[model samples]
Target chain A: MALDMKLFKDVKTIAHAGMDGLIFYFSGEPVQANQRVQQYMLSINHAKPDWLKTLIPSYDSLLVCFDCFKVDAHFVYQYLAAHELTHAVSIDGSHHQIPVWYDSPQANDFEQIKNQTGLDKSEVIKLHTSYSLQVFAVGFAPGFAYMGELPEELVCPRLATPRKKVPQGAVAIAEKQAAIYPFSSPGGWNLLGLCPWYYELTDPGDLPEFSVGDSVSFYAINEKQFTEMANDR
Target chain B: MTDKLPIGFVIEDPGLCAIIVDNGRDSGLDRGFSEGGPLDETAYFWSNWLCGNAEGEPAIECIGSIAFTVKARAAIAVTGPDVTLTRNGNACPSWQTLNVEPGDKVTAKSLSPTAKVYLAMSGKWLLNEVMGSAGTMMREGTGGLDGKGKPLDSGDCIPIRIGDADKKEVPNWLQPDYHSNEPLDVVPGYQFEHFYPLARRRFFSADYTVTSDINRMGYRLNGPAVTSDVQNMRSEGINMGAIQFPQDGQPIIMLRDRQTLGGYPKIGCVAPYDIPRLVQQQVDGVVQFNECAASDARTKWLLAKSKRVRYLTEK
Candidate 1:
């Protein structure tokens, strides 16, 4: 039992996550960090090996919530030594082409983003619609997805003071993450556009096509298109 | 009165934080919705049991004068901290089932030392289900009278399933004496053994007062500053009742509406049965946390659950 833990000493660090949870930390590169955690999460979900219950993946760590009565610390140590993080990216991962009304009247953040970053309206829009980002994690608010590690050139800071209420469907970016206001709630992210498609994309499931580990790309659309999608929901 | 599977209750007042809730949206956790049920489950179940309603039935929870008028005679129960309950123009005691006549006014409020209260109707509330829950996930904008997580507003009519026309109060109203100084059962989690021995000792020996800062999300405790050498712990799913140590050394007991992922290092989880009594503690109330094994906690929970089921079924 002692030697099993010694074999994987440098690869990962295992610790108690909670009464029924175990935390596994991996010192992996940024590119494969989330996937590595997801791989571990999938194993617990798919196999429930050793009485595993549920798995939550974050940056480079995976928190495994399990049935404590069914397994012990020895079981976790052996499991960690036996299984390794996989390299297989999900083939079923989806890409959503979200339409946006950038810097429109309601958004009114184009000038804000421009002044803060010294980038003009078109430049901001170009950078925002530049490429799709993956949903790294979902939290803070229900249906709120954290899409992240925005392109370095486009990274922005949070507002000086958060608004009392950021209307739903408002697209914003802050630090290294971008998120859409799922419900009309207070937030500090710097607004860049309004997707106006929240109802269309946020029902049936917490997020329509915005599952974690999936990718999303934005496309510039006229106000008319935005209104149409807004009404579509 | 029209015959319907769901009985209707018209709202005359929508108190602060009033919403339709049940056991919670536990299944919806993976789908990005937090499990937002009642903060006081023991009180919630007591209300349901008094009204002969089964488990997982929807009910109203609030902190103010949540008044309503019924279109038909109905049996209902309210439970929680002391509240000024009025049936029509007559004052009434809570914690037991009471029958109300058509047009009878029902209201519950606590002006001083306010705490949450649960009102369980004889029939479950009828509402559009989101992920199979009528309980409102306020942050998610789903579930409730309207499909948008809004609370019962003035003039709102809630549909409910009608049941046994005869109404009888429970044999005895449980006015359990909950001593704030009593130790809250804590289930030792994975990180329990890692906490400093002295810190663990202080946590058990000392009494932590519930701070004024509280909500459906969690209750913040102010007491012995518990510090851990590790900072910036990775975020993960925080089960209801987990005592989390945030950046500041204070421990916050995550409740039903807690965020899906939290970064604070949690020392342990409160036993599920203890959460009911924990939620009833008023602001500045003193509470002591005691460590117990998860196995013991689970066994106790199962036994209590079975006892409640048997009691309700036989009744």
Candidate 2:
């Protein structure tokens, strides 16, 4: 099909995110408001509306929820403002690469992020594996994520006390963001190492090798390729 | 063969914080999970319709003094807030239906301190449903009955499907009072007009206390700060009983293991039929809040789903 392009065109406010949800709001840039919230979550999850249920998508809105006994929020804001964000087709998610290790031993703030970004440790793994970022919010846990801009000399600042554990796939950063955690909780970010990949759901549409407008990249491995990808996980 | 025989129950003690909930985990909120269910959805739908099950099935929940046992003939119930239950030691009746068998036992006992209970049984447990939810989610360790989300301790077991009893009860207009001081309601809606209308009239004329920093992801109140001129925005989706705030504006609420995404400033949600009386109140208790409209919270969730479809079609 291939030709449906009008996009959230800066919609601004749909509101209500409560009595059975419905956020929307689009006002621009954060990669075009998460590419119009991943094209309105791929056209309302491909119009599967049995009064939808949960859609979520963040970094600039698209909550949704529905099904208060089959609809409301003004019939889901007039079926999402009478549709038309166009889509002959768009997909673009899953991009990964990952593989960190940034000198593992969970790189406990590798010398306090090389003295708060004066950039050492191989220029903070060459500006955190130079560009690819963009997940911008998976959440505060479960395959964590939140990746982003960074590179203003590798940002920094988080961990004024917050590390009661932080192990699983660690790799972190703060300010302009970058993350990884994905299950070994209690973290305060700023770590910088160990990414033998983690998060594991196993069904109910599984997901999470990366999500939320996905696109990763990192790449620096060692410590025996993080012990052969943590013994091939 | 009699629904492949197995039946459930085992945890002989568990006590403070049992788990295995249900009707949660779907589309794991875009990969961050936390919809672990039943922080008192009307005492988990009257403990799954007084154990004739299916008000979202899979049960247990608990909090402070559990027990368990059974493993053959079943049918259960319990419901919460000021819990009690009992069984082998006799005293039964929390919201009705009981009948056990095999090793029997039962237990429950919270009596307050913001109870929590639930239990529910009557068939269909056979666990395994991780992200589609057999619900435990000890903060994403994942579902339960050893799907690894941990919590119901002392021996474990679970499995299910043998059911029987049929006794039921719970009618005093489907019981749920938990000492009803009432207020709660609140269908406000995200950022509810960017606050400051005297901070939404001190959030519906303030009272708020409940803060032992509650759990199952949120509750925290403490009272009237409200603020919200909407600063750093962008980070959204949150809903269950929502409320939010935090910049010392104190609020919190968002339960059923919350955190799917946030950025503070919420001032909404709450009316899911008053989120099980504010998750059964009691830390320092005291609550209040009102404004409900959104079609009167969808006609109080369609009259509580038409009283669970007229008590499951008159049983």
Ten-residue segment with the worst summed lDDT in candidate 1 chain B? B168-177
Interface RMSD for each predicted structure? 5.5, 12.9
lDDT of 1 by residue, B119-233 (tens): 8778756666777688877767778877787767788777876665345454343343455456888876635555688988888789899888777778888999876564424
Chain A only: list TM-scores of all candidates.
0.73, 0.34
For residues A169-227, what per-residue lDDT tens digits would candidate 1 score against the true structure?
A: 78888766777777666566777677877744545354555677778887888888888
The CAPRI-style docking tier of model 1 reads acceptable
Candidate 2 chain B, which ten residues in sequence have the lowest lDDT sum?
B1-10
Q: What are the candidates' individual DockQ scores?
A: 0.23, 0.22
Displacement of the residue B290 alpha carbon in candidate 2, Å: 45
**Residue B165 C-alpha lDDT in model 2:** 54
Error of 2 at B66 (Å): 15
Per-prediction share of native contacts kept: 0.28, 0.57
